[model samples]
Target chain A: MFSLQGYGPSILEGTYLTLEISFVSLFVAMLLGICGALAKLSGSPVLRAIAKLYTTVIRGIPDLVMMLLVFFGGQVIVNKVGPLFGYNEYIDINPFVAGASTIGFIFGAYMTETFRGAILAVGRGQLEAGYAYGMTGLQVFSRILLPQMVRHAIPGFGNNWLVLIKTTALVSIIGLDDMVRKAAMAAGATRMPFTFYVAVAINYLLITTVSIYLLKYLETRYSVGVRRE
Target chain B: MDFAIIASNIDIYLEGLKNTLILVSISLIFGLVMAIPLAVLRTSGNLYVQAPIRAFVYFFRGTPLLVQMFLVYYGFGQFEAMRESVLWPLFREAYFCALFTFALNTCAYTTEIIRGSIVATPHGEIEAARAAGMSTFLMLRRIVLPSAFRRALPAYSNEIIFMLHGSSLASVITIIDITGAARIVNSRYYSPWEAFLTAAVFYMAITFTIVFFVRKLEKLWQRHLMPLEQLDTKIEAPSI
Candidate 1:
């Protein structure tokens, strides 16, 4: 019962890749979400329209299709354009970039919604008071809106992150050796789909459980300044 | 670059859309029916009953729907007993599998959302109903679901939009929905940009339409509260 068969290595390796993809994608999405939310909230119409388009398109398309289109379709674009620029080498999108970019781009839309709601939740009174005391919009945002927005946004952000982690399972279809794909491979090799898939489920549960705890900790820390009564 | 193939296959795409609609509508209706009972169970305060419902919600909501779909389809297909069993005919159909998963998944989310709304119904109203010697079932039927429908309406609308999008995933497992049609076109023609972009535009249009209806429904349902809310909002607006 305790035999370490063909399953262990692939599962472990896939776990690392999944974690790497998730972390990098989440970081990129956060930056993108913040910038997108700020752009939408910006006073300029052009910036707002652009932000709106980004979020709307990402939200509308199914995550699976987007991943396939970006991974397969992006490769085509890259290959076509590559040979035109003096030197042509066969450059393919590594599973990491494909996985990370797709997940990040999609979740960035969700995170934009989270951040926008949180920013709006930050009372406008404070910003007005800051303005009365000669604070600029940039100063008001950084010194006032940003902190409260982060706090209010934590739970929603946590939810989005959880969904994002699960969506990464789709990446396995396009040859990213994530936990799901690795388990599928192991299952193929070992002819035990149930056992391998169960292992994949556990891997996801582990990652999700740990992330929830971290999000909880961050939530508590962020609430410190505002919860003083 | 060849428009003729896609142009000629417009009928296939329409057929696919019809199948997608059938799957979505049936699952959503069934999900709604099941959710009401499950919501009642969840809020009943009997640990023996509520515990299982809680567990079911957590298990379903905590996991991705695609995993559940695959588990039902491929995972269960692994069992010869399942394949040959009385349920085999039903399970063999991708439509049934997708609908089953969609219904069950949406039920979990909807049950929680509905239960929250029911619980949030004014205690005064419940007391008034009970004070009048109303039966439990009667009170729930006449008072709870009706009132809770108002509160849950917003969340249910969100779920509706989500399920519409979720229907797209059914294509992955050979359901041949709108998304399935798009994939078929993409592979044969290698025009990923047009194929996928067209699908995205269609989905966006549908989502926008659903959202618009949800907003209208919200306003209609909340008509009585609007005046008070508007007054409160007006006061808060200038202050904010």
Candidate 2:
């Protein structure tokens, strides 16, 4: 049958992979973002320099290049290092790992800036107050700074996460069989590029709409005490 | 293979840099010109005029640019009727398709940015212009645009840098920009380290130029808009 029935399941499958990739990568990126922000604000010059280099290089390189490098370069590294590191001889980075890592690396740069700004936005005196309360640095960060930073970070973090989700579409070029690639294949098979592409666009719109609503709820829940103005 | 050996082929990298600059600058200039009216209409009244532009801004902003590029290039290419149309020749040219997509994508983002800036212009200034018997057109020209542009300078600088980075995506549709050139070199030499590294340096250089001008412009605006004494006395703290 020359219809969209078959297309739905394929797209739905791709959507699952896409979500899996984005969620895992975003989790990793969040870790890097916090670490990078702390490093930038740390007293250690070497750590600051290292963090700066990480963000700069990641931002400087195009995502497409980074994805390719990670995918191809990772394969080469794993082949050599896996045996030496006591892993399976045939251990290789699948497309999902490669895509997530590259996208995570790229977005982590942006998230670092977003997080650092959020951290700074939380009043400097707030941290001092935590210290005044006889809390250690670790305690101060967890108890006082982290909560406020989360509220401040939500808006910027949400925007960056949206971009991160869309950026996952680029992984299709590297054999991840994301929505775009599946659409391309289906279009090629059915000779209906416009319809197939529109299907993919609708899929993107659905995911994005759901994400925005979810983020809005989080924003509302987090901003409980503060006046929005 | 020593990475330093790639220096012998600096000429190719320079050529790619030249092309990348061409694509970025051309699209950005045209995008800027397109942004003004779009921004004006976006924040203006009249749902009939504003609704379509709003939808456009949402669509382009909501989706990934890579997919949009594919729609313009491969999606349209698949249409036989479109091929026979007057736009066919233009669309057939990969460079033209790349520029068109870049221009449209940047237009959406710049419109949103410029609209935000325009709306953020102090309401008191507009009221003062009205009280002083200024015409709508005259007030906008004399006060609104200049101030809005100033207000928008910081965000606009980031937009421009992004455009420069975005120009790399043109290579996906077969326009031989810097990234494409780098990929070619990598495949030929089997040394991605050198090729991608060179490309990264080129992007960093472009980014440095963007930041340099942005700093200079910010300083100029800082001087013109607010006196140094007041600026120092009250730093406008960033709110996330």
Compute the lDDT for candidate 2. 0.84
In TM-score terms, which candidate is top?
2
- Show where candidate 1 strays beyond 4 Å: A1-6, A125-143, B1-5, B228-240
lDDT of 2 by residue, A38-82 (tens): 999999999999999998777666787777777766776678787
lDDT by residue for model 1 (A37-116), tens: 88888899999999999987876777877887788788888888888996488888786788799899888888988898
Candidate 2: which stretches are off by over 4 Å?
Answer: A1-5, A80-92, A123-136, B226-240
Worst 10 residues of 2 chain A by lDDT: A1-10
Error of 1 at A142 (Å): 4.2
CA displacement after TM-score superposition, residue B79 of candidate 1 (Å): 2.9
Please report how far candidate 1 places residue A3 from its true position, in Å: 8.8
Q: Categorize the docking of model 2.
A: medium
- How do all models score by TM-score? 0.90, 0.91
**Clash totals, every prediction:** 0, 0
lDDT of 2 by residue, B66-136 (tens): 87887887778677789899999999888898899899999899999999999999999999999999998
lDDT, candidate 1, B125-226, per-residue tens: 999999999999999999988999999998899888778877888987898887888788888878776666666666777788878988998888888888
